[model samples]
Target: MGAWGPGIFSDDLAADIRGDYRELLEDQVPDDEATGRILAAYRHLDSDEVHVLWLALAAVQASLGRLDDEIKARALSVIDRGEGLEPWQEAGPQGLARREAALSKLRTQLTGPQPARRQVRRPWRHVTDLQPGDLLARVASNGDTCLLRVARIDDQRVGAAPVIELLDWKGQALPKDRQLRRLRPRYRDDGPHRPMTYRVARLRKKDPDWHDAGFERVAQGLQQQGDDALPPWSYCGWSQLGDEVDRLVGPPKAAQ
Candidate 1:
């Protein structure tokens, strides 16, 4: 089994993440900025978007040579900002013990043998560069891989962002009018929206090695959105309920 740590990544990629954090430090962005941004995303985004953001950040942190402190801080911030309440928060000593026991059990489950993660490559940086037939990666709530094929680009002006039709690996178009949107410029005005900015990279894959019935389920879930429209995560994967809460409250591990 691969050791429990950050996955392998190119030096250039690792340097890029380091550079981004360094710039944030240089610019004097508050340490809570990352945490705050994550909280904002949790508040504004749907379940799938939340999963994608968490998974992507976990991947980046893993690639960063295991900067445990930085990763731990971000996770703790999410828990705190989300206003989580351990039983102890209200139940006193008894609740504290229960919470600790629950947490310990969860840690064991999370650290159990996990399936190998899909190996992904660098993706197109610009949305405009995407072309029909390109495959992108989407992560499910359980951290499974879902590959989406770009069918067409709809760059018309009428929405918050341009939409791209995507198909599953089995040649089935996602239900409804589901589409992928590039990170909008609006979020960049005050500062780079980490979730929005990194979404383009997070939602796409440079390789196509997935074939599973889960892809059909993914599409059907998006179709069920009706007039609501599917969030980018619909094209990607599902986020298991308790798993997400666990990660938000503690140091993140590879989604699992």
Candidate 2:
């Protein structure tokens, strides 16, 4: 049976899935051996397809007290970037989310109270119920002083909006938080080469009350210039905020 159903895959292909199954069962296979199994499984599957297998490997590694940076990294990537929802879509709806949860927990386990790059024990804030096209937050980026907007993928079951995407100032996609199960043992940085931040004062200059709005046309123009000409000002996924972000969680209901 295929991931979603029997129609998407053939019977023999299903049978071969078992061969990969045993490979997944072994807990303490040497690095070379574990890697080979992962590779073999990889040839026949995608990151999302082998999510469990990768998660298992990371767990086992932790059990054995082994710290294989590369293995951990790959596992984290799978967790962060999950399987797409529709057969036609590239990523599943909850893929990135799973990785995010996993990453948060993993860091605590690995570094105790102090994780690299990020501080430990930051208060967690999130949207309880998310819908597609619900604007998250504008993040800071690598460019001189520009920022980019970030949005989540649409949920198939929920009939959400599609993800309007763009490359950062570097022509690379924005950084993404991974969604692995055991982030501590197998966490990976799926975040892009750069993380985008809010433009703060400059943004205040435009109109303190209005942030995401009025920036669409400017973002579009910068995006059209491509990464090369981004000048640290390239925008990604910045669509109309006229009624979208406001209706969801904009200035009106925002807490002071």
Candidate 3:
């Protein structure tokens, strides 16, 4: 995996496993079930990755006060065997020293008494019913209503969110069906042949007012050829939808 440092979680795979494990717990999955799911999810890992996975999971479990004997024993075994140090060894003596020290500290922590398990309340995750070709009307704070076309949907472990492209139509009133179908997606100006902008929007669970967010589905089943050629953008909070759309579309043109 990609590693930036010598810590146990310095590697991408380890860090991802830690996050996934904790998310499972937060979703009210029993510790054993969560551990089983994580293990099953990574069963494809080879020898080296297996070591990293077990160690990362064990460390996370310990910190969360849910460390079971099986996982702790497996992690300690990997550490004692120095099974996952191939990359560090290749990094030269200093790197190897740092990695070994980190492993040693992890071993000590694993063997120590862990704190009592903390209660985890299930979190409300953002859920979207939008699909490809669906059109949505987003009302901005300034009373400008923009049309956003759902180019695709990204369904991850967290939830589903739309990958949307802002259409070249914005007005005080939502557009008619004929107008929406004729509208082209706004493209970023700086690129050669200007590429259409795409962005993912997900409702923020922490935002108390997310339910009343100004998004409404207006139409569906509109598609254009070569839409799949557009580049993807990372997900943004629904609260930032208007600003992101404006940034992508640039300043509005002067009144014709």
Candidate 4:
């Protein structure tokens, strides 16, 4: 696991463990079941990674006031035994000292009174009915409309969300199928070095902007042979839709 610091959550695996545990809790899984699922999920890890996982999960459970006795014992044992310190030892005495301090702090927290059990609210998961090749019209508040096409559906931890391609067409009315066929998809500068063709904007039911944004499905199942070859973009928020559309279609026209 990649670790940037000595803190419990500084490691990628530890952070992922925390997120996975909370996700299970948010889904209303029992504490024991969540713990079991997490352990089972990471059971293939080597001895060092297993120690890190146990410590991370136990710390998270303790903070949530749902710490199991067995988990706490396991974490404390790892701390006492100084397991999973090989990387820190390699980093030198300073790094090892910091890691040991972090472990000491965690041990104290685990042994102390935990906060009362907190309720984990289920997040509003975005589920899209749009399939690949479905055409959509995104109507801006100022009456301008931009066309977008669903390139693919990504099944994510929350739910299935559409990955869209912004077509290079903006007007007051939807264009003909033949007209759309000739229009190229817009590209955005991903960074200094890369330009991206697809935008993965997550549209959650709970997002107020999504409800207000005028979206209409105009066509469906229009997949072309090369549509599958488009590179995927990272997921973005629904709120970024207007700015992204503006970048391709220009800002919304002023109202009379």
Top candidate, metric TM-score: 4
Candidate 1 runs further than 4 Å off: 1-23, 26-89, 92-94, 98-128, 131-163, 166-233, 237-256
Best by lDDT: 4
Q: What is the TM-score of each predicted model, taking all chains together? A: 0.20, 0.25, 0.72, 0.76
Model 1, position 217: C-alpha lDDT score: 22
Each candidate structure's count of clashing pairs: 8, 23, 0, 0
Which is better, 1 or 4, measured by lDDT? Answer: 4
Instruction: Please report the TM-score between candidate 3 and the true structure.
Output: 0.72
Residue-level lDDT of model 1, residues 117-188, one tens digit each, is 333323333234444334444444444443443333434221122232332221223323335332111122
Candidate 3: stretches off by over 4 Å:
26-29, 128-146, 151-155, 170-176, 191-199, 206-234, 248-256
Colliding pairs, model 4: none
Q: Candidate 2, which segments miss by more than 4 Å at Cα?
A: 1-29, 80-103, 110-256
Which residue pairs in candidate 1 have backbone atoms (N, alpha carbon, C) closer than 3 angstroms, thus clashing? 136-205, 137-204, 137-205, 139-237, 140-237, 140-238, 141-238, 141-239
For residues 68-100, write the lDDT of model 3, one tens digit per residue.
899999999999988978888888999999999
Tell me how far the alpha carbon of residue 11 in candidate 3 is from the true structure, in angstroms, after superposition: 1.5
- Model 2 C-alpha lDDT per residue in residues 25-109, reported as the tens digit of each score: 3333455675576557657665545644445455444434553566577656654564332342334446434444554565344
- Candidate closer to the true structure by lDDT (higher is better), 1 or 2: 2
Ranking by lDDT: 4, 3, 2, 1
